[model samples]
Structures are given as structure tokens and as C-alpha cells.
Target: VSGVRDKMNMLGAVTDDGERFIALTPNQFNAEVAKHFLRAVQHEFGERLVIILDNASYFIAKTLKKQAAADGLLLEYLPSHSPELNPLESCWRQLRDGRANRLFLTLDDVNEYLSTALPALNSPQIYEYLC
Candidate 1:
């Protein structure tokens, strides 16, 4: 027997003031992909940004550090083993549990669900996690 499998990676952030963003990728997380997400956040905020993050290697990569510096962004890593301190973790949990116990026929179907479901995650209620 065989089972179909697909992989999706997301880079997400929530500002202390309630702005939130998400980028979906087919490839694994790395400095290059991280640079893209940082650029997007910079584009949206158009000001110096401070992002609290977990200790993912790519998040601390020299290349990504240079990109953030050039873009006037700050990357702050959370304490080890402290996922609860990162607001984005709550966002992911919400997204995952939002679709639990459901099935999709294709990756596109899943993307479609996310396209709609993700915005729902922007509600003022969820923004509380950032505070």
C-alpha cells in the first residue's frame, strides 16, 4: 500500500500591536526563505521591526542577520524550550487545530482552506496572544 504525502512550510509573525502575516513555502525553512519573510514584514511595516523568534538555526544564520540589518529589522530569539513565549506558536496551533479531523483531496484543497481559514485567524481575539 502507498500513501500520498506533501510538505508545506510556513513562516509567520504577529506584531505586539496586532499585525500578523504568513507565508507558505514548499521547501524547508532556511536563511534564504527567512530573508524573504523578513522582507515581506519590512514591506508591510515600512519601519524598524522587532521580531521575537524561536532558536531555529536559519533564524540565527549570518546571511539572515545581514538581511535583517539591511532592512532595519531586529530578530530576537526566545529562551530555549520556551515555545509558550512565542505568539506565533499559538497561531500555528490555531491553524492546525482549525482543520483537525478533516481530510482534503489534494494539496490545493488544503491551500484553499488555508486561504480562507487563515484570515479568520486575524480576529482581535487571536491578537490577544501577542500581548
Candidate 2:
């Protein structure tokens, strides 16, 4: 081990049909991250995106809503305490399963693994999580 350990905050989203989008951040989820995610999705899939999120405080921020509206995006909040309604949660579970028992010397190592691992979710076998 290099004796270097770091905590990386990440925001991720999955499409209803199994595509994955993720971002690594130095801090917790906030309006900035939320806006970045919105813009990233819009840039990837074009305008008029509808993103569904859990009851995370940042997702409920008025500033975020305003910014999303300005970006021609829509934000939908899932029912409280009902994680099963969000298909992205299953995608995260699969990510956790894939990373289980792995050891990383640096955050980049984890990020690299995730970069490869995430796309695997597009495969027929792993794609079930989004269905």
C-alpha cells in the first residue's frame, strides 16, 4: 500500500434503459454538483431532460430547481423512504457488488475501476439492474 487513502464523493445517475452517468467530486453533493449533473445529462442527451432524485437536501434546493428550469430540465422527487422506486439505486448496488473486497491505493485507482466497470452495466447481463 502507498499509505495514501482518500475519500472521493461521487454523484451518479442511470437511465431507464441502463446507461450510466457518474461524476467524481471533492466534496459532498450540493447545488453545484446537481447543476453539473443536469448539464452533463443535457449535453449528452440534448435538452428537456427529466431527472428523478431521492429526497436528498441538495435536490430539493430552490436554487437547483431554478437552475434546472433555466436549463430546460425537469426534476422529479421520488416518494419519501421509497428507494425501490428509483432504478438507479439498483445500479449503485451493482457497483458496490463489483467493488466488494477490492483494495485501492489511490482514489484514481477506484475511479479507473469505476470507469471500466460502469460501462459493463450496458451489457445484457448487467443491464437488468435498470429494468
Best by lDDT: 1
Q: RMSD to native for every prediction?
A: 2.5, 3.7
Candidate 2 structure quality by residue, lDDT tens digits, 1-131: 67655787777776655566777787768877877877888887778788878888888889889998888888888889987776766667887899899988778898899788877764223344335
lDDT of 1 at 98: 90
Q: TM-score for each prediction?
A: 0.86, 0.81
Residue pairs with colliding backbones in model 1 are: none
Question: Worst 10-residue stretch by lDDT in candidate 1?
Answer: 122-131
lDDT of 2: 0.76
Lowest lDDT 10-residue stretch of candidate 2: 122-131
lDDT of 1 at 42: 82
lDDT of each: 0.80, 0.76
Off by over 4 Å in 1: 1-4, 122-131
